[model samples]
Target: MTESTGGIDMDEDSSGTVKKFAFINRKAPYGTVYALESLEVVLISAAFDQDVSLMFIDDGVYQIKKGQGTKGIGMKNFSPTYRALEGYDIEKLYVEKESLEERGLTEADLLVDVEVLSRADMAALMEEQDVILSF
Candidate 1:
């Protein structure tokens, strides 16, 4: 059985079953802690040997956008962290095409490479996830 600490299972290998974990990010990178919090949780889940994926929709796309300038707002830019996700073996990243079009952005505007999916396709992907944590 997995050992629990403060309600979180600390044993990464206690469960032999590998579950697909999808993190849906729908908020902007800053102004709120949701984006950063989601990123942290995704890393933790990946470390647990779970199949992890991140979906960026709505303003969440901004989290991985390149050329982000947070210094003017007294905040440190964390966009580069998204690029490092590959080192953790957590690579499945998706962005909603509609969201990018609405914001006048394209894949080139993103810092890390991500598959651009249509709203319908994104929904289909979400349905395949064993667990979804939205932020």
Candidate 2:
């Protein structure tokens, strides 16, 4: 049996099948539905007691940029939700070092704490997951 303070529980009857989920977000926020949908999936997975990790690459890095204002674009901002991941027991967040540099961004530009990884290291992380999902 497996149980944690985070609220989900898995017993031996389930075969201890907690899978690693790595969500790769590569889209910019507020253009389409990718970013929001990806966040929703991550929360749902985490609530179901799955091991979850989130990665921001390409323009996806913008999704977690601090000080986002959607009023100019007539949209409601959802960036703040990133800060709540830890409350759901999902704390693994990764950002691609190359992607941030390519866009003139630094780790300080992000709203959440994330491990900055080189492309090679990021690839190694992808290899460690049982499931890989890309937004």
Candidate 3:
């Protein structure tokens, strides 16, 4: 069994089982391509009926902040689409507590409800996932 220092046991082949995917997003919504790409990945994963979850760390938390107005930049604000994730069965969303504090944001600042996890807790949660994709 290959044991990861992250404490993840990757010994089992989960081919036929429901795949658990954790997407780690650590980029801002605009001024970069990470956020949009991450969203597309989420959509594609959901389309495959995989159990997908999103974890926003660092500046990525801003992607889901409420009242995003990008019309000034001639871009359609995609904040509202996060709410539509539930329709695709992509429900588990997480935000790192330290990241929120570093950026001076609170749970009230987000567009959707998210589970706030400590860095250690988040690491443990990541270890439980069958796959992790970071962007």
Candidate 1 vs candidate 3: which has greater TM-score? 1
TM-score of every model versus the real structure: 0.88, 0.87, 0.86
Write candidate 2's Cα lDDT for 8-49 as tens digits. 335666656787778899999999899999999888887678
lDDT of 1 at 68: 86
Candidate 3 Cα errors over 4 Å, as ranges: 1-15
Clashing pairs in 3: none
lDDT of 1 by residue, 1-135 (tens): 122111333476757777777889999988899999998887787778888889999999989889888888998788888988999998899999999999999999999989999999999999898777878
Each model's lDDT:
0.86, 0.87, 0.85
Candidate 3 per-residue lDDT, tens place, 73-125, comes to 98768888899998888889999999999999999999998999999998899
The candidate with the higher lDDT, 2 or 3, is 2
List ranges where model 2 is wrong by over 4 Å: 1-15
